[model samples]
Target: MHNWNDPGGKGSACQADKDRKDATRIAGQLNIPIHIRDFSQNYWDDVFRHFLDEYAAGRTPNPDVLCNREIKFKTFLQAAIDLGAGCIATGHYARIRKHQGHYQLLRGCDPDKDQSYFLHTLGQQQLAQACFPIGDLRKPQVRELARQAGFATYDKKDSTGVCFIGERDFRKFLAHYLPAQPGFILDTQGHPLGEHPGALYFTLGQRQGLGLGGVQGAHQAPWYVVGKNVTHNTLTVAQGDAGHWLDALRLLTSQPSWVAEKPPGKSFLCTAKTRYRQPDQSCQVQVLDDHCEVIFEQAQRAPTPGQAVVFYAEELCLGGATIEATDAAFGGLEAST
Candidate 1:
């Protein structure tokens, strides 16, 4: 496996010191010669710069997804093939199956920990050569398997934050490069109700940290972030009322992928999840040449623009795409065509 050391080979200087140490320990235990490349400063700096550039362009790019598709699968796969590796695998929670001479993507059995959404950006070729050892098992089962196998990370707390940057508060990490700018907090009706520290700090459906108070005042009933206008520096919010939060939406997806032999045509029924943590909701899917749209049966809240919307038909993962737009007006509709 190929891994890059974060800046200065500073296994000692960076927050990822523990990871480096763990990697070393694992390699020693497995008797594997781990080759470490020192891209260090240039690699990390370039990634962060690209992230800021995308965000500034009003596009919510999932950096992890990009890294996996572009670097890990594409670049690393080629390198591994050159070195005569038979196959590659990762800790991803996605399953691959062969159907009609094509590779299909499926959700891991662990409902709560499925990560097929992150792997949605991968194409057909990558899916063919990838393996997921823990795909069929739940988190607890994986831990038990690890314990039985005598692996040290059997009980290691799940790693949080970005792939190699280690766990840091997202706002704090971004603030280091992108300073927060104060913005206006508005109600759904475009009424100014409060002030936000920065538009970049908040996301759709976020409830905490708005600093709004009172029993019956603006944001008094535990407001949820509804929308954001980055250009105007305004964040729209709503109370946690069923009527205010959305139940359904018209999700415009760009650059869709299919793991099946045939693409589901326009207006087909399926289940989908807007966020990784959310349960798959019953919905109808429509496939276009370049995009697919989903309309959930029940209203879902905070379908953020930059996040993935993964679709499923029972156990199989059809595909997913980044949420491009949402319509509050279409929330109560039976279907969104």
Candidate 2:
């Protein structure tokens, strides 16, 4: 479903009009019937609202994951079924296959464009009723096919990041909804280096938009966000791009949605990605009563809480969980023995 976040399209230069026009032309070309459904309220309530709440609570959340689970699959999929459609197809670059009376989600053939990372939350029912027509095709092949079809959108630039936040200053956008609570930016030694607009506005390991380039008495080394204290309204930073405090070798997650109706086992070895486009990292997972623990084979950098961590076995996407906390070991850990 297309986003209805922009009303009248004034703020974004009439992008809504252009999208509608392109969709209408394409539908006409294929002789397929199209319906215009307003899902503005749904998006605001289910996706964007939660995005704001997560940020307010001192976490960075990925809206696309929630949108795929709540709006795209749940709301839009149900709507399509009501229209007498047997199954709905979309442009998502992921594949679904049935094995032993169950459906399995797989990565797209185009590794660079694989979107199963965001689709890991989907369960058996959603996978059964969903179709990804381009899952087996590479991106260039799809683009060439579209070019052969005389479609105007064949060469459209791919959109990245959060679509609603498009090209606008993200910090400024947050300021519009969350009032700035200016606080001191302190160094690792508890020395105040400068001031920041808000601790909630930044995330761990972030080095940009900190506005600390001109601080005196600070070394020439760059600063990285290592800690955020909302209670004291303080932001603690550390110098050096390879700061030891941001290393996260283990993390905890909320309950996960598994593709096989349960985790592969009580504990299993799998490759996982903590963020989109991140290369798979070797990790060992242990399932618990209320949460799951992941121990990385190698120390991970900045596995931020509130982001989704997806598990993979070869090309199969097993499932995913929302990161709850990480052992961001400060000053490095000593040997236990």
- Relative to the true structure, candidate 1 reaches a TM of 0.84
Question: Which digits, one per residue and each the tens of the lDDT, describe model 1 over residues 220-267?
Answer: 467877667778878777786634554445677676766553567767
lDDT of 1 at 32: 90
Q: For each candidate, C-alpha RMSD in Å? A: 3.7, 2.2
Q: Which residue pairs show backbone clashes in model 1?
A: 7-40, 205-225, 246-299, 247-298, 247-299, 247-300, 248-299
The TM-scores of all predictions, comma-separated, are 0.84, 0.95
Per residue, candidate 2 scores C-alpha lDDT tens digits across 295-336 of: 888878888888999999999999989898877754223311
Error (Å) of candidate 1 at residue 312 is 1.1
Query: Quick one: best TM-score, which candidate?
Result: 2
Q: Which stretches of candidate 2 lie over 4 Å from their true place?
A: 7-13, 330-337
